[model samples]
Target: MYNLGGSVYWNRKTFKKWFATRPINLKWMLLVILVFPMFAATWEMKKSSGFSPLQLLGLLVFAFAFMSIISKKTKAPNLFFLFYVFLFLLITNLLLVFFYEGSFSQFGDTIRTILPFLLFFYFRKHLNSVIDIEGFLITFLIASVFPISTLYYEILFNPIREVYNTASRGGGLRLSGFYADLFGYMSHLICGFICYCYFYIKYSKRKSKHFIFSNVGFLFVLLICLIGIYNLRHQASWAVSLILLSMFVYFIRKQVSAFQLFVFFIIALGVGGYFYTQIFETLFAKDIAVYEGGAKETAALNGRVYLWKKYYAFWENFNVLGQWIGAGFAQHEKSSVMMSGGMHNDYVRFFFSTGIIGILCYVSFLIYLIKKTLKTRIVEFKFLLLASVIVILMYSISALPLLASGALMYFVVAIASQINKNIV
Candidate 1:
């Protein structure tokens, strides 16, 4: 009974210090845990009785973030602009949902779309240094090896032959890995590979043994990703990757000689030309045909142009304020277009779902993020932010990268904001 309470208090203080100072890259590990399972969530959704692995992981991350805030271990950023834009969008969407008698799913989906921004802030708080960012990227690259390996095995062995029978379809082999489909797999791969390239460029000259190992590991991961991209036969991913590579070259031009630049350009052009030729021969070489009604058709743009036209036609029915929320979801199902997926364009999707206000909010958000990036003092971080923005913009033209797993784009912006604030 002699000072028992004092002893317990001292023990608690010691524990907190140990927790705070513990090494082993806890923040990087947390980011990896948060993101890596997303690749496997689609597959796990079928096997699980309730929430999928991805959802559980999200809840866990959220719990940790909430506790951190409560304990004062980390403070949330003063994201007044972002908070205002998000709140406005949410209020408008809620009003629309009420007026249109939208389903709960519609309201929930809207919330889900914006939820990533919250997670982005959580990550931004933890990723407080360049080393933290680098560690996170490396962890992601390592975690990616599992999915990539599974994709290769499935392609080569076809363990589930019935499930993969569609690989020989007209568009060539499409390896979905553990994702819902090939497109989902491509999205993750594209973003992860771009981050790997950024890290490689920034750390290639470091003399640290750990960095040397990281470089070699990243090279292997890059090779696997390249092969996966080829097998997936996604033109959008290919185009984005080519654009990012070119940007990387331009980014490093000052560091390399003129002759080096020329050689790099020549190699890039040669490789790109060869890849384009193969894509044309293998994926787009369908025979032209004329219907009995004298209609000529070719497999141009993989029918994306026709899909865009149909969505545009549907957009005509919406008023200036839009049909409220869930317009894209509701209309896509009712329309007789027979499209295989959601609206391929994010801008069009937003206009239909949230109307002009939605579009304005989105544009303003981009402008703000870009302005912040421009003000960043770190050159590597600035280039990474700009490259990511360009890639996301390019991706938005052909696909909706602002929703679903595409929320990762906001994660990049959040990181940029943290860097600008001198928090990282």
Candidate 2:
């Protein structure tokens, strides 16, 4: 404590020293800063074209991350080669922008897409220990509470007008929360649910009463997350959530007693059965009706099938090398002149924008990461990485998870990379 004008206070320098000395504090601070944009959504920012406060905060975090990487004298991990491939892809895209006469919008989009990968390397370089990773995850869980609260608040008191429109149009009200779109909101929830399951499993391994209570609390949070996903009414998100939860249970089944597993199955089945009707209605009925009505009927998948057909036909016009430069947003908008939305499929979008070479590079990078992750001794981290990869791959079939929620994707990758480094 230090005296300031006759008042006692915790000295700023003392606090700074304490924070810097503890690795966990630094990890938590980094994670909170990385996740800050998710919770700082505002109406004015949404309506305006300028950068939001959170984006500015993100830039500051990036600056801090760059400085940290430069100041540290640690050796680079073996996995650093992945960054070379990413940089190559970035350079290829930049070349396309230059050679293809791509607009500023295209250049901007490319930068946004690559920024998260750059940040991931910075995070992997800094968060080196198991305790640091755990602390970062806990900080992520804490940060998640803000968006979850906002989601429920919108559900309870401030339903957007589009909610009524969806109901009127014979569909569910898609929860957008503070996000600009439902997909972004659902992606954030997916990350939160994963963290909750991870912590629940971590605590359940301990036999102490406190750990048991914490496990029960985390279970409650998991249920709450399920409800939140259901409220979003996104079929892909629901499926991914169920898949991740199942993976978690299966992973921990060996650690639990037979009776405990039986009880869990019973609870899951009862809850699932209760929600079966709504789930079926939300996931299948609309699509089934559209299919039965033939070509005259409104296409299901929110016109995704139609958009894919159009984009695929357009893509055929390009040679085997495909469009070297990304088909800028302007081109996408022009292609969707008659339609209301985008291609929705990331593979299609990637092929159209970056061509077959980009796809090969991207797939190779994922395979490399998966191979590395599987070789790690940290079973829990491996399970989390594999589960996240599966969900992200599935999600990419319908939405561009990398382009839309790349930061979260890289956050998961960074954690896995650090875990693997620790093993070596």
Best by lDDT: 2
- TM-score each candidate: 0.71, 0.79
Residue pairs with colliding backbones in model 1 are none
User: Largest TM-score belongs to which candidate?
Assistant: 2
Report residue 60 deviation for candidate 2 (angstroms). 4.0
**Runs with alpha carbons beyond 4 Å of true place in candidate 1:** 1-35, 38-44, 47-51, 59-83, 94-104, 155-170, 204-222, 257-263, 280-301, 304-315, 323-341, 374-377, 406-419
List ranges where model 2 is wrong by over 4 Å: 1-39, 43-46, 58-72, 80-87, 98-104, 160-170, 183-188, 209-218, 271-276, 290-300, 323-342
lDDT per residue, candidate 1, 1-424, as tens digits?
Answer: 1123222111345434533553433553344444654635454574666546655554554466545545546565565364466446544554444345465544445454454545555566666755456545545554555565677787678733223312212454466655665654564576676676565555534454243225347446656666777777766677777787677667656645577567557756765797777664454433211223232342234555566666767666754444443243343443212211266666655555555555667667767767876776655566677766776577777675655543244344444446345732
**Relative to the unseen true structure, what is the Cα RMSD of model 2?**
7.0
Report how far residue 371 has shifted in candidate 1, in Å. Answer: 4.4
